[model samples]
Target: MATASTIFSDCSSSTTARLVPLSRIRNGILQFRQSVSVGWKPKNPSLNFISTHGRSSSSIVTVAMATEPSATVIDGKSVAKKIRDEIRSEISRMKDATGIVPGLAVILVGDRKDSATYVRNKKRACEAVGITSYEVHLPENSTEEEVLNSISGFNDDPSVHGILVQLPLPPHMNEETILNEVSIKKDVDGFHPLNIGRLAMRGREPLFVPCTPKGCIELLHRYGIEIKGKRAVVIGRSNIVGMPAALLLQREDATITIVHSRTKHPEEITSQADIIISAVGQPNMVRGSWIKPGAVIIDVGINPIEDAQSPRGYRLVGDVCYEEACKVASAITPVPGGVGPMTIAMLLSNTLVSAKRAHNFE
Candidate 1:
């Protein structure tokens, strides 16, 4: 059996060795309480990645690159707000000159409360950006043909420029069939096989990128994080976020590695990355130890877990333990305020772009 020591053998020594605590190496997350400041700071030339300073001879712990709390909190909510304002500005300009307003259509199947909430949020986002929103909420018992008909209707509508089918359709429905029914140009959610295929090709660009993945990359760009030549690791291989995210990173010239469920020594692989996008939906699955100091983290997982202290009896958290990660990562996104808001922002952005292309507004 590989102990924490053996598992972390590759991360031995130096100013830039990967930080891995023995407790995390043994299990998933260590049950400990600590706090660190989460904000950006200017880099000091004198400060550098140094050796472990306060560890006992027998203690199994690694040191972060910097002594000071250097990690910057990636403010996704503020960034999302900025993007929405920008979209709103562009939308106003297009409508004023060309009398053309972007429109987004959503086809939501089933009655999952969470799914309904997401659809509502998307509508609100569209309206805020001056885009019209069209929606169809089909009952759980609706036939696949009925859903396809809705998609076809929206596809031909001149006013509707973007279409999204809310995911996790009823167990009886064929998700793939329904998703492919959407027109390639109107696939704003970017779940169609063709969009993903285009995203994978070097010379090709996706007509619309998956919202969450696009937002993650946008956060990086908004913060001026360099992607070219940086090594990135994406945990999870789901089509929605992880796979597309890795593809986008690769397109930007970042060397990419994907960590899935069967990956061995996941921490070891994650630590090698200059950027980590964790979308496994496992709360706090990534601990501080798995990160490379100075690595930028964009957490996509929004998991709800029981919390006795909360009034709702539960709270949301991301895959990376924020408190721990803040200590090591040069920048990171918070859970509810991070990827969540950005997803809607990207959806609006895509809708605006689709309308612009359809009408050639610009």
Candidate 2:
């Protein structure tokens, strides 16, 4: 009886044998015997005998390793860094050629800490990319007309290429009114109803895609992940992330299924997906068993959970259970370091794209 290690070592030493190591040889033999046991001939002998030890196979296995690649950690931080650098170069070139600097105007109302933080980050990203940042801060009791007027000013300003109204406006102010007032061309956040509607419809191109969802799709593209003809499940139906995500996936020719709070047996449906984008705010809503083997997971949730051990007394969490999902999933995005940075990057990208289109830089 050839021990498994001995067989693998011997196979590794062979040149002409096209040695199939025991790890794969066991699977191949089992598949062959199973076919024979069912009164069927193994129709794919070449596939069965081929050694799965090539560079591509090794690269994939290396990425999928439990402790080595850390369960296919999607490095959104690094990806965002690259994108920012590209944007910086583009801005420098645009300035040299056309002598115009793209400008982004952000309107922040009220004192919501989260919204403030997001606005600050957006400004910092603009500064890094050589884009001018115009920020308008209003009190919590600011009138709806005041917010709308700010948007109106940015709309007429030829230098301003992008306008983003920080979300969660005051209770008295109308959110839709403020967002709709932004000119479609300057609506970098893509919250305007017209952009959202265009994004949802087929055969139409949206002037801008919402930042977070666009970031997720950019991640998939950067990684060379296949999406066409694949089954993708987007958990959540919010207009911001989930709905736009599903629309984008559909645009890529993926068969998309949108799951919401009312959805029953969500896991049963999710288990069939080749790709899962969970944006539901519930922490750990998705488990290991809910994911298909070799499935790609994009976790868009950023719920804050209480933790006494942390300095902030709260920590960010995603909808999927990171620990368990790592075991079953082929690739996954971590909570804080993953989708968060990409959102800002995509916003900058959309701003630059808007500026180029406005100036006909292309």
Give the per-residue lDDT digits (tens) of candidate 1, residues 1-362.
Answer: 11111111121121222232211210111121221111222133223222222222323224332334646777789999999999999999999999989999998988987679888998988888899999999999999999999999999999999998887688888888889989999999898999999999979887999888999999999999999999999987787888999999999999999987767667778878999998876656676667888899998876555555569765666777665566678888877777778988999999999999999878
The RMSD (Cα, Å) of candidate 2 is 14.4
- Model 2: weakest 10-residue lDDT segment is 1-10
Taking every candidate in turn, the Cα RMSD to the unseen true structure, in Å, is: 10.2, 14.4
Candidate 2 segments exceeding 4 Å error? 1-70
lDDT (tens digit, per residue) of candidate 2 on 1-362: 11001001111101122211221211001111111111112133321222322223444433434232225778788899999999999999999999999999999998977678878888999999999999999999888988988999999999999998887677898777778899999988887888988998987889999988999999888878899999999987777888899999999999999977667667777889999998765555576657777788998876555445569765655666665566567788877677878988989999999999999996
Error of 1 at 132 (Å): 0.5
Per-model TM-score, in order, reads: 0.82, 0.81
Provide the overall lDDT of each model, using Cα atoms, as 2-decimal numbers.
0.76, 0.74
